[model samples]
Target: MFSDRFDQLVQALRILPSVGPKSAQRMALHMIMKNREGAIGLAQALTEATDHIHECTICHSLTEDDVCHICSSHERDDELLCVVESPADVMAIEQSGSFRGKYHVLGGHLSPLDGIGPEEIGIPYLIQRLSQGKVKEVILATNATVEGQATAHYLVEASKHLPLHITRIAQGVPQGGELEYVDSHTLSQAVHNRMRMK
Candidate 1:
């Protein structure tokens, strides 16, 4: 068994997603014994990031600024809006460099049992934005999961009268797959081959 501080470090490391107790302990040991400087840098970066990072006002994506670059950019297509479940999905799509449109991050998908509903994930705000009529196309880029599909369908129904073209990314993303884990080429192709849902 290690000291209290070491145990605390391991516990803290375990706070990261998918990090188990053994992995946390190993990471703690590596940070303390082999990469103390690197660990310190990582700690500072995390602290600074947490201190500054906040959601973009327009798209609900993580950004240090009030508005994300994509939302504010003039070169990006203002008529095309890609709706994603999380900021990670936004990052994945951006990394793919396929879609030249703006984005609307839903924050999360619909989960009735979990009590996550339309208002809970900023769907009303999305409808408001769409109602403004700046965006002509709405790409339902939510993950391929059941909840994601439900959310997309709900959005389609919710904004049926908005007079905007609603489309869904191609099925190349695989069934029940999250966007963040999908490969760039696959994401690109999916965006390219998107089908109209409305």
Candidate 2:
């Protein structure tokens, strides 16, 4: 319903997560009308960031440097590892300021139907990290969704024999809510009130 250029913009916008055709059109028009320069800057930033960013070798979080800030920081506890589904979760935890441990980004949760299994999401890497005998505790900070729960259970079962204490981040994170969307206060409380899984 738009010109070729406008349609191209809409198509590009639709590739983003949670953006539908209507939203893509609305955003495209909004950018075109409100501030074209700002829109161009946004596009440039996206391009530059995506091109420059690479996964942190130690944690798998997006970073321009070889190691992420958390992995390199002396302030973070090396003996505690927080296992999260994505980098966004790391940011949320960091923002809450409740955890001072390093993180291991799983890349994503296990979804057999989607062909995302243990190997695909770096579960083996996690086991290897545990085998090194540095980390003492692993906080299963995956989301509360079915896939997240399944991933957490799998990790717990797999690492049962290892010399590490496994704990899951508390629930009560509003049903269908994500870590990135939860407020800092609620996230802090959840981290503080985390319970050991039986």
Candidate 3:
């Protein structure tokens, strides 16, 4: 239905999450017709970000440096840790400006069907961090998805021996909500209304 280059562009766009073939085609054609400059800028930005971003050594959040700004900031509370499923979750929390603690990015959630396990997403590292003695509380900020809940439970079990308070963000978030998609006010409210796991 389109030229080889256009078809290739659509296929590439389709690789993005939730972007079906129709949407991808629409985007490709839009780029070709309406917003060529913006499209070029977007492509360049994507390439640059992909090339420069590296995982933070301490928290696994994306950063250009070895450590992310949040990890390096002395203003944040080192005794509080927010465990999230990805860097995007960290960003969502940051946008809310409600949390002034450190973060630990899990990289991904626990999904048995997808074969992602504790070892696959650096849960061991988080346990090790908790063992270091300064952390007082851990906020489970993973998404409200099933896999996210499973990951949170795994973390709770793993940190059982540690002298730390573990809590999960509240559920003002709609079902099937991703942290990245949640608005700042809702995310902030969730953090403020966090509850301890029974």
Which ten-residue region of model 1 has the weakest summed lDDT?
168-177
| Candidate 1 Cα outliers beyond 4 Å, as residue runs | 172-198
* Residue pairs clashing, model 3: none
Report how far residue 148 has shifted in candidate 2, in Å. Answer: 1.4
- The TM-score that candidate 1 achieves is 0.85
Give the CA lDDT, 0 to 100, for residue 153 in model 3: 89
- TM-score rank, highest first? 1, 2, 3
How far is each candidate from the true structure, as Cα RMSD in Å?
Answer: 6.1, 6.3, 6.5
Q: Of models 1 and 2, which has the larger TM-score? A: 1
Checking candidate 2 for backbone clashes, the offending pairs are none
lDDT of 1 by residue, 161-181 (tens): 989999998667887989999
What local lDDT score does residue 80 receive in model 3, on the 0 to 100 scale? 95
Deviation (Å) of 32 in candidate 3: 2.1
Q: 59-168, model 3: which lDDT tens digit per residue?
A: 99999999999899999999999999988899999999999999999999988788888899988888988999989999999998778888888899999999999999
For model 3, state the Cα shift of residue 130 in Å. 1.2
Kindly state the number of residue pairs that clash in model 3. Answer: 0
